[model samples]
Target: MDVRLLAASAAFALVSSITPGPNNLMLASSGLAFGFRRTLPLLLGVQAGFQCLLLAVAAGLGVVFQRHAEVQWALKLVGAAYLLYLAHGLWRSSSTGSAAMDRPIGFFKAAAFQVLNPKAWMMCLSAVGAYTLAGAAYWPSVWRLVALFFVLGLPSITLWAVFGSAFRAAFQNPETARRVGRALAVVTGASCLLVLL
Candidate 1:
């Protein structure tokens, strides 16, 4: 891989990973509700899931997506529905502070969620297409991009979680927490628009 291309890929990974999407939004919400330590599993899961996604895209999954518009549409519909469901749950939990809110998203669940995350798909597809080389150098280049993303992305996503956790103290009051939770839920639900687009 060219050093310049690798550096550009690193910047892409950092920006994409840290941006406010479903994963980061959920991570922040989880951090606020569960604190950083409790949210660590979800954080790790996002990284693991995204890496798997990037690998798959590098290995030709992007071709499958391109060839089958129906499949992509199906994924989009399902992803949008799932995000709506999660948004509802978040909204409800904010109002009642339900037992469901007490439990954070687990590692496996978060990992699996990548399959339905449109942003993850976009990031993986874009990264693989843009950063990789052809033929003999392809695998090596892909690996480099993967490692770069893994290194840069960790701290980027971690910042989102930390940002949310930082607000935990201020949101301790029931009313304040509920208001914040509801707002987060709205944003989460709105993210589904990105999926459909």
Candidate 2:
């Protein structure tokens, strides 16, 4: 890949990772509930899952998605359901003030979550489609783009976790934390609509 193309891939990766999305929002929510140290697994798991998705797309799985409308519909339904469930969980956690919320989502669970995250799918597909140069030589370009994304996405995503932890101080009061949690719930739940869009 040309140096310019590599730079563009890095820029796109950072922007996509930094933008407010289900994963970043959830990371922030988890950090607020469990603290940054505790939410680390979710952060790492998301990166791991993302890399796998990127690899799959590079290997041409995205074309299968392009051909199968029903598959996309089914995935959208499942993803929407999962997002709604998480929203409800966050809502209940806020209302109940239970320690259960302190248990951050596990590594495997977070990794599994990437498949259901429509944004993740779109990112992987778009990266492969847009960043990789066409022709038989595209494999090298795919690897380069994936590598750049992995390198750039880490700090981009970490900022959300750090920001959430910073909110810990601002939300020192139980009531304030509760309010933040409820607000997060609304954002998280609303992400479900992205499936339709």
Candidate 3:
């Protein structure tokens, strides 16, 4: 395995995992609404799901996506729709102290959500295509990249959840929490537009 490629893949994984996307945004909302302890399962679920995705991409799933443009478009459509649905839920929870607002997304649900996350797909495809070498070194390089992502992604995403949790004190007031939740909802919705574009 090339050291340079490994380093590059590490950097890519860190940047992509830490950046605001559907996963991080949802995690932040979960942290703010439910606290970090409750959000830990969701965070772990994302890592599990993303590592699986990376493995799948490394194992030729990326080839299928590259060959099927319509499939890619369909995924984007579904992902955008799902994001919109989640944004609506967040928006609704902002106004009412309902049971739904008290519920944070669970491990299985969060893991399943990765299948519909366009950002996750893009990250996997790009990493597998750009970082891994061919021939005898292929599997080794792929494994290295996966390990790198797993190690780096966890803390990067944790930071988002932690950041949201930090605001819990400030958002102790119901009105303030509502406003922040609504803002997060708007941002989440806007991310859907980006996915579509």
Candidate 4:
């Protein structure tokens, strides 16, 4: 793959990966409660999941979904429902309890989340459309594209985890932590909804 093209793709991937969204919000929360070390699964999940989505999109699956209005609507509905479910989970947890916050979410669950995540879809669409070269050798281009996103994605997601871990110091009380978690959850879900709009 061309180095210039690779660099450009990586740059675009960084912009999307680092941006505020549901994934970032959840990462922040996880990092705060579980610390960067524990958030590794979540970070890996984000990269692996997006990598799959990018592959699918490059294979023209996104175009298929884009062509079908009903399919798109169904995806939105599912995404909304999932966000609400996440919101409820966040709300039910202790607002300030460090014990409750210590455990990060499991890997499989986080990986599955990418399927219904609107933000993930948006990122994939953007990457496939903007980064992947149209006329270049298909396999090389795809590999390079995937590499660009993966390279930027891991660090970007980790940063959110670190941000969350950093916030731990601010909430010494379980009650305060619970309240903040609930609030962050709400914002996270809301951010997902905005992608549908």
Candidate 5:
């Protein structure tokens, strides 16, 4: 694998992991509700799930979607629907209560969501499409790319969770917390739309 391509993959992972998305929004909510320490499992689960997904994509399973138009559309449709669901949750959050929120999502659920998340899938697709070379060396390149992502990905995701933890301070007021939660949910939904469009 080329050094430049490796750098690009790292950069992409950093941006995708750190940016506002369903995962980060949930992390922020978890942080505000349960404290950063409690949310660690959730964060770790996300990283693990994404790494697995990347591995699958690298192994060519993700490429199968390219051959089947129906599968591609199904993924997009499901992804769009999930984002809308998240948006509704946000738009409906209460604005005037103590930062009362559900307990943080468990590791299993968070990991599973990664499989369904459009944003995650898109990131994997973009990485595979852009970085992996063609022809006889493709498999080797894919393996290197996956390894690189695992190395670069964990820290990048951790940073986003930390950012979410830091934002917990803004949730001191119940009403404020509720309002912020709703806004975050909306952003999550919007991100899904952005992927589709």
Candidate 6:
């Protein structure tokens, strides 16, 4: 890839990775409820799943979407439904006595979440479309795009969790924690509006 193009791609990856989208909102909520360490699986899942999605898009999933327009439409519907489901779950979150006993979106589940995450899909598709070079070096370019996202994404998303964890002390109170959970639910639910758009 050309130097200017690579730089532009990196910038896009950074902005998209760090922005307050569905993943970031959920990660922040998870961090507030479960703490940083407990939220690791969710983080890992997002990265792994998004990497796979980017690879698939790079390998011609975009073309498939072009050929079968209905497929994209169907995927969008499914994605929207999943977002609504997640929003409902967040809105109804109950206070857990123990972090260990509480299951906050596990590794495999989080990874699978990417399929339903419209933001994740958009990021992957945009990355592949904007970065991957045509010809022999295409795969390499895709890998680099993945690297750019991974390197930026892991840290970018982590910051949201860290920000949430900063309020861990305030959440020590049970009543306060419940309110926080409700607030997070609102935020998470609002993030799902993007899917509707």
Q: Which stretches of candidate 1 lie over 4 Å from their true place?
A: none
Cα-based lDDT for every prediction:
0.88, 0.84, 0.87, 0.76, 0.73, 0.78
Residues 1-197, candidate 5, lDDT per residue (tens digit)?
A: 57888788778767776776667767776776677788888888887787788778877878796788788778778767877875665556544353334567778878888887777887888888888889987878777766766677666666666766786777776666777777777677677767576
Model 1: lowest-lDDT 10 consecutive positions: 93-102
Lowest-sum lDDT 10-residue window in model 4: 93-102
* Predicted candidate 1 versus true structure: per-residue lDDT over 42-130, tens digit per residue: 99998899899889988889899979999899889988998898789889978786522659998999999999888899899899988
On residues 141-178, what C-alpha lDDT tens digit does candidate 3 reach at each position? 88888888888999999999999899988777878878
Error of 1 at 147 (Å): 0.7
For model 2, what is the alpha-carbon lDDT of residue 128? 91
Task: Please list all clashing residue pairs in model 6, or write none if there are none.
Answer: none
Candidate 6 lDDT trough over 10 residues, lowest sum: 93-102
- Give lDDT for model 1: 0.88
Look at candidate 2 and tell me the lDDT of residue 160. 91
- Give the clash count for each candidate: 0, 0, 0, 13, 6, 0
Query: Arrange candidates by lDDT, highest first: which order?
Result: 1, 3, 2, 6, 4, 5
In terms of lDDT, model 4 sits at 0.76
The list of candidate 2 runs beyond 4 A from truth reads 99-102
- Write model 2 residue lDDT over 69-115, tens digit each, in one string: 88888888898898888889888877887532658887888898888
